[model samples]
Target: MKNILVTGAAGFIGSNLVLELFKEGPYHIIGIDNMNDYYDVSIKEWRLEEIEKNIKKNKWTFIKGNIADKTLIEKIFEEYKPSIVVNLAAQAGVRYSITNPDAYIESNIIGFNNILEACRHSYDDGNNGVEHLIYASSSSVYGSNKKVPYSTDDKVDNPISLYAATKKSNELMAHAYSKLYNIPSTGLRFFTVYGPAGRPDMAYFGFTNKLIKGETIEIFNYGNCKRDFTYIDDIVDGIIRVIKKAPEKKIGGDGLPIPPYALYNIGNSKPENLLDFVSILQEELIRAEVLPSDYDFEAHKKLVPMQAGDVPITYADTSALERDFGFKPSTDLRTGLRKFAEWYKEFYIDGKR
Candidate 1:
């Protein structure tokens, strides 16, 4: 059985990915999360509870800790001896980085350095060392680029936010470690990921919450923004595929490189306008019976100027993902929103009608 360690296991994407891994068979999983109150601690706790309920065997282990602690991280790698390590624990939100820039530096930069160091030394155990190190990057790295349908080949030199800078730093750090220690690492630049149990800070979830409370939903950029929203299941599938296929060492005429590294964009490849997305979401909410059939969505939506650290549009060119994995996120906006609405109604609404 392959031993895998997943950081930020209580997070939306991380928790969903962990559950999927559990269903795949007998594999040792070391799930860790600090359970920070970035959005809501209850949500993280709830995700953990769901995972606990599904654990028929002792394959899943949960540890409440921060990824920034080098000692704790090193201990996990030493004890668990995970052959596959997935680092998804980072200060998430672009706007949050503005007021809390230090958090980004601590978690995304220093914390990731600790992870790289641990992975580097993990080879001390002759037989039990990480074969692949896959970490989460973000499409935010392409901040405000003039190009449409962002590609991995695009020069991502300009980042508009601290969050994007930290993510880009992670990729660079991973590259350095890969070259120095020969760690086979892959960085996935994820697009706007949304689904059931999504982050409350996200527009989709926030809009739903505000609409339910009869509060005006803030539509940033006067509702002109567009995003390539990728579903949670599709993101997990891409991660799993990349995990199984470690990057190969690029051999040149000079000599074999020290390490192997690769980066790919995982997205739906289709961008949808914010208004269209909200309309679909409103429809789904009504269809799921979470909202009343006569709910006035137009009255609830309030168009506003663009907020700081936000991009106007994000479209992903997933050719690399498709070419390598033969997979892409095909779930339409309505389908994904439907699942989210259904789950929200069952979990949070409590049949409130």
Candidate 2:
């Protein structure tokens, strides 16, 4: 069985990916996270509980700690000797980064550096160690670009938020390490990932919470913003495909670096308007009994100007993802949101109480 170390395994995407990985076969998993109260520790803990319930034999090990802890990360690498490492643990949220810039610097930047260093030194035993290193990048990197579908080849030099800056920095760091140490790494620029057990700070979940509480929900950019909302299952599938196939070395004439390293945008090609997305979500919530059937969504939604570090739109050009993996996120908004509503009712409404 392959040994895989997945950081942020208790997170929405990470937890879902762990469940999927377990289904593939018996594989030893070293899951690490700080379990910070950034959102709700109970939600993260509940996800772990669900994983444990399924894999009763304990094919997974959980380590509660921060990724920025260099000694801890290095020790885990030395002991587990993980062949594949997926770094998804980072200080998430674009708006939060504005007030808590220190968090981003410490977790995203410093923590990422630690992960790279550990991966580099893992080969000290004179073995072909760490065949692949996959980490999370965000669509926020293409901040305020006038382009319709943001392509991976587009110049992403301008980042409007600290979160975007940190993500872009991760790409640059990975490139330098890949060039210097010949460690095959891939960075996935996920586009607005959402679905069952999604982050509460995200628009969909936040809006749902306010709508249920009979509170006015703020609609940024006067509800004109668009987003390429990708589903969790699709993101996990794309990760799995890319993990198995690392990038090929580009020769001198190609204008690309030598060695196996690549970056791809995993997203739904279709960009939906913010207003339409909320409407669909409202419908799903009402259908799932999370909200009253007669709930007045129009009265509860308040249109407002864009907030600081907010982008107008985000659309992904998944041509590279399709050309290479022959797969793309195809789940429609209604379908994905329906699953999310069901999960919210079961977990928060029924199970938690």
Candidate 3:
């Protein structure tokens, strides 16, 4: 059985990917996470429990650790000798980067460099090493770009947020490593991903929490922003398809490797207005009985000016993804929100069993 190493295993995307991988085959999966209190430690623990509950026992292993520790990461890579490494364990959240820039630097920069270093050394002495490295790149990398349908070909030099800057740095670093080491790498720039058991810091989850408590929810930029909100299942599906293939390794005209590196945008391709997204979310919450049907959503919403490190819009050009992978994120907003609302009612409202 092939060994797959997933960093940030307890995170929203990390946990989901782990569960889905078990369904794929008898592959042995190794997962590691720091289990930080960035949002809620309980939620991360719950995700781990869910993975254990769903997957076949003995096929998977979970290690509680941080990837920023170079020694720890090197140890994991040496022991597992993973054929595929999925690095999703970065410090998330654009706003959080403003106050806590250190976290981003430590995890997003240092941690990723450690992973790349491990991958580079994996091929030492003619031993077969990590065949492909898939890491999470965020839509935030396209910060402040006025271009609609942000393409992989677009230049993303101006990052409005430190979080975005870190992600862009990841892409560049990966490309450099790929060229030098001939490591097949793919970076996925995910759009606004939302679903059940997602990050509480995300807009949808935060809005749900605030609405349930009868607190006002702020709509940034007066709800004028548009986001290509891709659902979690769709994101997982896109990732699964990506895992089966690696970029072709080839020598360039200069007799050097052309860099076996690739990047793709995973998004719904349908950018939804922020105001409309909230409306649908409210309806879903009421439908799921998380909120009363008579709940005054309008009274609970407050439009606010744009905050620091925030972009007015994020649109993705997924044509390259469709062309290569023959798939794209297609989960509609209502269906995804409904699932989240139902989950919230069960996990938070009823009882977190």
Candidate 4:
């Protein structure tokens, strides 16, 4: 059985990916997460509990530690010797990075460097180690582009937020490592991932909470934004397909290793208008009994100007992903939001199981 190491395993995407990986594998998984209270620590613990319930204790190993800890990360590499490493442990949230920039530097930048160093050393002494290194990138990397459907080929030099800058830095770091040590790396630029048990800091979940509490919810950009909302299941499916395939490690005539690195946009190709998305969310909330049908939806919403670190629109061009993997995220906004609503009712209202 191949050993797989997944960092940030308690996170929304990480936990979902872990559960999906469990469905078809004789593989052993080593999951590590710092469990920082960026949003709510209880939710992270709840995700871990769910993972514990599904897989056998022996088949999976859980490590509650920070990836920025170089000694600890190196020890994990030595002990586990994972053939596949998926780095998802990064400080999330574009807005949070504005106020708490140090957190992003320590976690996203330092933590990623530790992962790269560990992967570099894993190949010591002719060891067939770390066949694939997959890390998470963000749609925020495409900052304030006038173009619709952002592609991987588009130049992403201009980043509006520190979070976007760090994500772009990760791609450059991976490229350097790939060229130096022949590491096969694939970076996935996710576009507005939302689903059941998602990040509470996100708009959909926060909007649900605010609407239920009888509070006014601020709609940024005067509800004139657009987002390519991708479902959690579709994200997991893309990650799984990417994990099985590694980039072709080739060499050039000048004795330099042609970096076996690739990047893809994993997102629902359709970008929905912000106003239309809120409408669908409101309908789902009422359908799931999280909000009353007669609730004054018009009064609770307050449209405001765009925030400092947020973009007006995010549209993904997944043509390259489709051509390479023969897959595309097809989950509609309403269906995905419906599932999130049902999950919210089950988790927050019905005693949370």
Q: TM-scores for all candidates? A: 0.96, 0.96, 0.98, 0.98
**Total clashing pairs for each candidate:** 0, 0, 0, 0
Cα RMSD for predicted model 4: 1.2
Candidate 4 regions with alpha-carbon error over 4 angstroms: 56-58
**lDDT of each residue in 74-168, candidate 3, tens digit only:** 89888889999999999999999999999999999999999999999999999899999999999999988888989999999999999999999
Order of candidate numbers by lDDT, starting with the best: 4, 3, 1, 2
> What 10-residue stretch in candidate 3 is worst by lDDT?
54-63
| Highest-scoring model, lDDT | 4
Candidate 4 residue pairs in clash (backbone atoms < 3 Å): none
Superposed by TM-score, candidate 1 places the C-alpha of residue 194 at a distance from the truth, in angstroms, of 0.5
Q: Please give the lDDT score for candidate 1.
A: 0.90
| Model 2: per-residue Cα lDDT at residue 207 | 92
Cα lDDT tens digits for candidate 4, 93-115: 99999999999999889999999
On lDDT, the stronger of 2 and 4 is 4
How many steric clashes does model 4 contain?
0
Candidate 3: residue 73 lDDT (0-100): 86
Distance from true location, Cα of 153 in model 3, Å: 0.6
